[model samples]
Target: MLEQGRIGTRQLSILIFMMVVGDMMLIYPSVITSYAKQDAWICALVGVPLGMALMLMFLKLSSLYPEENLIQILRSILGFWPGNVVSVFYLFFFAIGASTHTREVGDFLTSQIFQYTPVRVIILMFVITIGWGLYHGLETIGRSSELLMPILIVFILVLAFCLLPQVDPSNVKPASDVGVVPILQGILISIIYPVGELIPIMMIIPYTLKQAHRTRDVLVAAGLGNLLLAILVTISLLVLGAFLTQHNIYASFVLSQKINIGGFFERIEAIMASSWLISTYVKAMVYLYAFTVGCAELFKLKQYRILILPVSLLIFGLSNLVSPNLTFIVITVVPYWIDWDTTLSIILPGLLLLVHMFKKRWKTKSSG
Candidate 1:
């Protein structure tokens, strides 16, 4: 194996949790609320179990080829040349995912905090950090996630408590008044995001130390992560009201800005920013790792670490050119991004699973 480092199910769960909650806190409320209105939280709540069910299929796929990543699975199920062709599609998918994630970090830092700094500079710094993480390997990233997980949990608790005073129960009133169709629309998005995008982790899932409880731990972690997201969406609606939450680009960030206890603890929106940074950092790092691993496997390289620098450089350029600005992301990319997620994460995985089962049965009959 190119990656020799091994992590337990615990670290893997933390990584998944981080991936699930990452950028959604910043942007999801606005979009979901626009569809389901106040019942956006309802959609999120409904999404938790559905997302877990989806995750189960992914886990089952990984177990089907316990020693192989998705690229190898594709090759095994499909033939050598055909599998490589399909794998190329994943290579492009991972590359685009890495670029978009890097751009998100850069965009948030420059637009919200460092108005004077060039986005290129911020992106450069972020890319360098990711490269450093990649050079060290997956174990380093997993251990770091274990450390960050507690801090992330603290941030979540503080956020919930600090914003409680501002919550208005009436805001979420008239539940589902927008009708079942809109709520269903909101649910579809809730699944597409965070959950649907989990396909990249198939690359790293093989690195995890197997245990009887591996699947349970990871699913529980996802459930915990999505439940917190639902709570935050509810809080955003309650504090900002459905209309404002729907229109505001960063409703959770704005929610944090409202935190005040006798004026001493005011202006701690930075906490929310810090939380976002930790989560996005993990998610972006995983996508980059997947891309690098795919490149190494495609070419039959000895190790993936050597390709990190050039791949990082390519992604740096792509990040700047991915879209013109945040408006493009909000207005144009957000809609299509879900479709992209559906294709790569859902459609592809399901296809592979079907072919794998049919081939297994055929081989059994042949041997008989």
Candidate 2:
């Protein structure tokens, strides 16, 4: 059953914005820069429409069965047994996704800020904080996001502006120096990582108060977020150069370190780091909430909150298992994650839409 609580259209929009650009702002620029070279910004621009297209697929699926979330929609469309199997797979996908985010939080903190801190301690703290948010309820998460998102935006914009003096326009020249193929590849990567991973929003859409126009809100918010991402990528390329950005693991953090305003704003990578931590917290909350809620619905449980602790513990364990070293995590995200994200975000939803269309037509023909 869908939850009794509802989030406003604006709140939902903000949540979607945070979800898309959250952890992505810190990680994706360098990955795209590696593939697209000086034309990394162009890849981000190209990804905007592709992301919108993916968002529309999600909106369409939700609209067809307004009363049900994705798990229930799957059951309705695919039948009980098969849908149960697929739902379990989706639950597993969400768990793994959340685990990766958890690991990312730990990894970033340990590698960049707290070098001596144990990763296990960092992960434990991160999970507990997000778990507390989940335990409070979705409305709490939505309201918290609404409050924090503007501050996050302001920090990012300030950092970007501060870095302007250091940016080399010449660094971004020779656009398409590597030609269309790599730029297209970069666009796909952008789509898969930030834009396409929006598949989880399927669970959130049913909770929107303005169900009829949620699609437009999602598209607009996601587009705005992608525009911000593109601008960040442009800044990263201009300030750090494509070569340095491609080689650096934490390019955005390094870019933050470049900001020096009369020597006062020096070493404000902490601000950038804090902003990322806030955004990642929201992203992890969304994933964990989806997993908890979906599992509750699957098992016909009365309350999702009851599952929070167990799930959080499980996620904490899985996060450690995600990688023994940061290198393995990078290896997975660079080449392998796109395929996994695409299967869940694009292919699965596209197939579901096709089946629903066929079923509708069959009903129409029978009635005639």
How high is each candidate's TM-score?
Answer: 0.97, 0.97
Candidate 2 lDDT for residue 67: 75
Clashes of 2: 0
Candidate 1 lDDT over residue span 113-192, tens digit each: 99899999999999999889889899999999999878878987898898888778999999868998998889988887
Residue 300 displacement in candidate 1 (angstroms): 0.6
TM-score of decoy 1 = 0.97
- State how far residue 28 of model 1 sits from its true place (Å): 1.8
Among residues 3 or more apart in sequence or in different chains, the pairs in candidate 2 whose N, CA or C atoms overlap within 3 Å are none
Q: For model 2, what is the alpha-carbon lDDT of residue 261?
A: 90
